[model samples]
Target chain A: MALLEIKNLHVGVEDEDIKILNGVDLTLDTGDLHAIMGPNGSGKSTLAAVLAGREEYEVLDGEILYDGEDLLELEPEERAEAGVFLAFQYPVELPGVSMTNFLKEAVNSVREARGQDELGSADFLQYMRERADMMGLNADLTKRSVNEGFSGGEKKRNEIFQLAMLEPKLAILDETDSGLDIDALKNVADGVNKLRSEDRGFLIITHYQRILDYIVPDHVHVMLDGKIVRTGDKDLALELEEHGYDWVREEAAAAA
Target chain B: MSTTALDTSVRPEDRFISAFEVNHGEALNGTNASISKQRTDAIERFAELGIPTNNLEAWKYTDISSVIDRPYTLPLAPERPSLDTDDIAPFLIDDLDAHRVVLINGRVDEVLSDIGDLPDGVVVSSLAQAGSTHPDVVEEHYGKYADFEDEALTALNTAFVQDGAFVYVPSGTVVEKPIFFLHLTATEQDLLLQPRHLFVAEDGAIARIVEAQHSLSDAQTFTNTVSESFVGEKANLEHYLIQDQGPSASQVHTRAAQQKDDSVYTTISATFTGEVVRNNVTIEADGSFCESNFYGLVVGKDDMHVDNHTFMGHVQPDCSSNELYKHVLNDESTGVFNGKVFVSRGSQRIDAYQQNDTLVLTKDAEIYTKPELEIYADDVVCSHGATTGQIDEESLFYLRSRGLSKRRARILMLQAFAQEVIDEIQLDSLEEHVAERVRTRFSSYFA
Candidate 1:
């Protein structure tokens, strides 16, 4: 069985019943890095949001199985506790709540849900300092409010720092490299590479091929109009980068 | 009893209009002629304006009918109660030298107060005594700063103005210690007391004053007070008003502070009592480069009602104003906040900001907040925002999921929300005291 499997997922917002994700099917096994590249409004981010259990979108139909468990049945925080993490494209800022406090709360929450002992304050601080340094984040950033007054690059690096701290089994990077510079992009990619394990998997969503050069994926899928039109090896990213998406659209129309 | 006749003609016995006229007529013969004239003019204005109803924009949410239903008993030849310094020792602040002025049943208890240490050129005395000795100073600025035309409570306080404190800081002088004014009301019968305060800080002078209102008995009483502060050029004044009366009491207080060139005025108000309470604070920047800071925190539980109205006017150029008011309502309590800032046409380079935020813990609790800014100056920056909502559910859940019980999570979030406002208080001891009281009140909710 696949480590993460989605069979005909259909989702949309509550107020407007217009579907954003119409029957999207994908599968990824452990230790695999898969990139889903698509144009704007092609439901790329919707898939990542649905996998992370964002309440704004309603799952009208379908099944999302994570390690033989129904992922759709869990709450967002519960899904987070179940080793599923989504690096938001736009991170929410919480004023008056320090970054260290937020990470400690998130980490201890997952640990408590899994019937594991919580880390002490000293140990948690030491762990956060190490992960923060690895992500090229200053220790002072952890003392300030979470994501408040942070530059775009610093915000992205902070996301990866949280990813390293939580150590989710299945991570979804939703346009994580959109606003990052070359150096910040390398730092984030290095943080993701450090977290790669045999029991872990990643679903990288992006609109550009520049990030692919830093963190190469094993498989690349082209998503068009809420469905994966084609799937190929890492060379497909290079092909799309060189030939653009119009050729894939014509081929997908012919195949359909 | 004719409806049309009653509406057309202004009668001297009308409940709303007559209350002021009667009190003013009696106060003309009092010891202070300047205060007396000011009261007379204020009463005439009160008759024209009448008591504000719900239709009035400023008094929309808070209705004063319950307290104004019957005539308040004005104390007559009230005996001075015997009280010692030991009686008020618990309320004193350590490490600061303070002059204590105690008022018992709205009358000054001169025998019990301590006026020992005094800086040169500084004068502190009873308002009645000061009226006789310093008539020129009294005539110059007494009651001239308060607007009795529109405010009925100010008119009422002027109409029945009895005994209160008077403090005068000379030019270029700084009072190293805070002056404490304790207003204690103890009555067997339902009474209405109007306590007046006139404070003047001359040019480049600095002083700190704290006023506390408390009651000895749980009797039903109505206390209407007006405190007017005048700050001279380049002077600094810090004023604190703390209202913690009994649960059976009701109070309406109007405080106004006038600022001159380059002067700074700061006011912090904390209200934690009264079955019904309403406070109106107004600050006018009448000189260039003046600054004002207004901060308030209110906690209401059960069926208590607390209303706050604040107005800051920037009439001169290069002035700044900042205001923040926070409320925590629980049970069936209700809170109202109306904050307004006005920048005149020629008042360029003025900066003003106001914010009112409230948190309702229960469905029955209600809060109405309206924050507005009226700016005519093109070069000025003014903004006002008001928000009323419950605590953030995600933050609460995040806390609860981390081994903290549901109750602990709620307490932590509520404390954190209130801590923002508490942190703005510059006095560390007072801030800690207020925080402790807030925590104690919050703990009762869980019980």
Candidate 2:
């Protein structure tokens, strides 16, 4: 069975008729890395938000299957406990919560839900120190409030650090490379590459192809007008980068 | 023709005035001439200024008529209700290494207290005892800082200032552990308790004090308390006031502090549960290079009402004051914060900032926050801000997306909102206790 399968998903903002995702269908199996590349308003982030069960977006019509069960029926936290994770495009700043405490709660909550023993303080600290080093997250940042007074690049790196700590089975990265310098981008990609395993799936949503050069994806999908217009191997990302999204639009229009 | 005479009903203030006139001689039996004169003058002041109504600017958001209009047995000469340590075990913060001073119905109960051996030349005793044992100190500092010329509640408290905790640290002496004042109100009938405390830290002395009030019974209680603190030159004083009473208990607390040159004074007030709690704290920067900080947190639920009114008077040059008060109101609870900062003329290089933030959880919850800054010095830097908002949905979602349950996520958000103020608490044990109390309160409400 596929790790995640979204069938005929139609979503919109709650209490509004303006649709964001119109009959979008996608599937990802275990060990598969799928990259969704699109323009700004192509609903790539909306699809990611819908998959993560964001409350603002209403699932108008569709069924999301995770491991052969209805995924949309679960709350965001429940989905997270079921090994689904969403690295937000814009990480919210928690003014008084330290990163260590937040990560501890998240890790323990997931572990408790999975019937695993909670990590002790020493073990958790050790784990956090290692992951933070790998992601190049400053030690001082971990002790401060979560994402508070953090630079854009630091926020993105912190998200990646949280991803490593949570260790989800199917991770969704929503424009994680949006505000990153070249070194920071490489660091994030390297962190993602290290976490890639046969039993874990990834959905990388991006607008630029520069991130793809470091963390290669198995398949690249072009999204247009709230739907996937074309799907190909890694070369499709390069083709799109060279030809721009205009050709994808023309192709989608011609096909329609 | 029917006579249209004016409707003149006896107000709550008139009732209080009558009660004072009837009980004045008995209340001042053992007091000195100075204290007796102060008491008489204060009651006269109270008569001139009655119980404040909502019509007044300071009491605009909080209406004390409903609480004070009813008849209450005044604890003028309160009989100490015998309370064992077991009875007050719940009120004491665990692992708090401090000298414990117990007060029952406003009078210190030495039998049940545990004020351990203190350093030499440090006096920690009841106000009445200090009046006799250290007459000169009491006369010099008592009733000095807390001026009741305009405040009716403070005046009323002064009129009935029978007994409370009084600490005097001599020059260059430091009270190693905090002096914890545990105020317990255990009565079988409706009671009104007025407890007045005086704390004086001499030159270069340091002292940390903690005061927690609790009502042991279900009877309606109204507590009017006034405390005056004098921080001497280069002296440091940190005070914490915790009010965690029952549903039937209400309190009107006034704290005034005068800071001397190169001294630092910090006051943190946390109100968790109460019927109607109003706290008025004023700090006067009387000397140069003085620093004052005021941090307050209120987490109220279930019809609880907590109002925090603070004043920072920057009277000297090269002084700074920072004030922050946060409130979380749930269910039908309400909160108010009115902070005023006054910078006198020629008080150059003054840096004063005040901020009040509130989070209203339910639709019926409300908060009124105002920050008043009156700066007469053009060269000083002063800024004030007040904000009332709901819980941040984005932060909640972010927490839940990390796998926390909705209930836990909401509680965490509230805790984080409150921790910003709790983090300012310098004492480790007090901070832990407050953090635990806030977490429990938030969990129960969210649950």
TM-score of chain B only, all predictions? Answer: 0.91, 0.96
Separate DockQ for every predicted complex: 0.10, 0.82
User: Lowest summed lDDT over 10 consecutive residues: which window, candidate 1 chain A?
Assistant: A92-101
What does candidate 1 score on TM? 0.79
Q: Per-residue lDDT for B321-414 in model 1, tens only?
A: 9898888899888999999898899999998988898989899999989887888999998878878888877665444323344575576667
Residues A1-256, candidate 2: write the lDDT tens digits. 9998989888889998788887888899989999999999999999988888889998889889998899988999999999999999999999888788889989998999889999999999999999888777788899998999999988988888899889899999999999899988998999899889999999999999999999999989998888888999999999999999999899889988
**TM-score of chain A considered alone, across all candidate predictions:** 0.97, 0.97
lDDT per residue (tens digit) for residues B234-338 in model 2? 999999999988899998999999999999999999998889999999999999999999999999798999999999999999999999999999999999999
Candidate maximizing lDDT = 2
Worst ten in a row by lDDT for model 2 chain B: B1-10
| Model 2 DockQ (Cα-based) | 0.82
